[model samples]
Target: MKFSVFLDLIISGAFVLAAFLWYLASSDNAKTRREKGDDESITKAEIFKSWIIIILLCILGLGYFFSFIGSLSL
Candidate 1:
């Protein structure tokens, strides 16, 4: 049970960090006009990937929380 709680907290922190990173990435200045208009990277897709990862981590944490507590004797 204690282990589950600790894992949950870690996962929560990871989610928070991912959110902050997404916000920071979104808030970056637009590319300069002279830098080339046709080139683009998959930064947004990567951010989305991070979001998915964080969500999965949260789900795993929840599962661990429930399973651990349910199996423990009160």
Candidate 2:
């Protein structure tokens, strides 16, 4: 495989790993907050932020995939 393809795969894998870590950390935060009897609003905000990160990642990944496909057709 070409070097470019290999680089792309590495970057994509890094993004996936980052997202997974973000999710795990967020969940742990929420759990700790619940255990402390903190306000629900704080937990909700954390969850929302997590969702936003996931959505943004998905958008970026899709954009990269489509651009790669476009390049192939050129």
Candidate 3:
């Protein structure tokens, strides 16, 4: 395949990997908090940060995909 297609695939893969890692981390964090009792809990800021990372990765992946498409039309 072409270089752009290959790059898009890589980006897509990276996004998926990042999302999975985030999910695992959040789950682990929640389990740990539960084991620690009611003294600790997840914070809004932490959730917000995770969302921000996911959003940024999604945006980057889409941007690369669009750029690949644009390149094809030129």
- Cα lDDT listed for each candidate: 0.56, 0.75, 0.70
CA displacement after TM-score superposition, residue 5 of candidate 3 (Å): 4.8
Clashing pairs in 1: none
Q: List runs of model 1 lying over 4 Å from the truth.
A: 1-41
Residue range 1-74, candidate 2, lDDT tens digits: 46675455556566767777888898998999999999999899889989799777766666666655655565
Cα deviation in Å at residue 39, candidate 2? Answer: 0.6
Clashes of each: 0, 0, 0
Sort the predicted structures by lDDT, highest score first: 2, 3, 1
Worst 10 residues of 3 by lDDT: 38-47
Candidate 3 segments whose C-alpha is farther than 4 A from its true place: 38-42
Q: Tell me, what's the RMSD of every candidate?
A: 5.3, 2.2, 2.6
lDDT winner between candidates 1 and 2: 2
Error of 2 at 60 (Å): 2.5
Worst lDDT window (10 residues) for model 2?
Answer: 1-10
Candidate 1 lDDT by residue in tens digits, 1-72: 566656655665665566566555543522342244533555546556756765665666566556555556
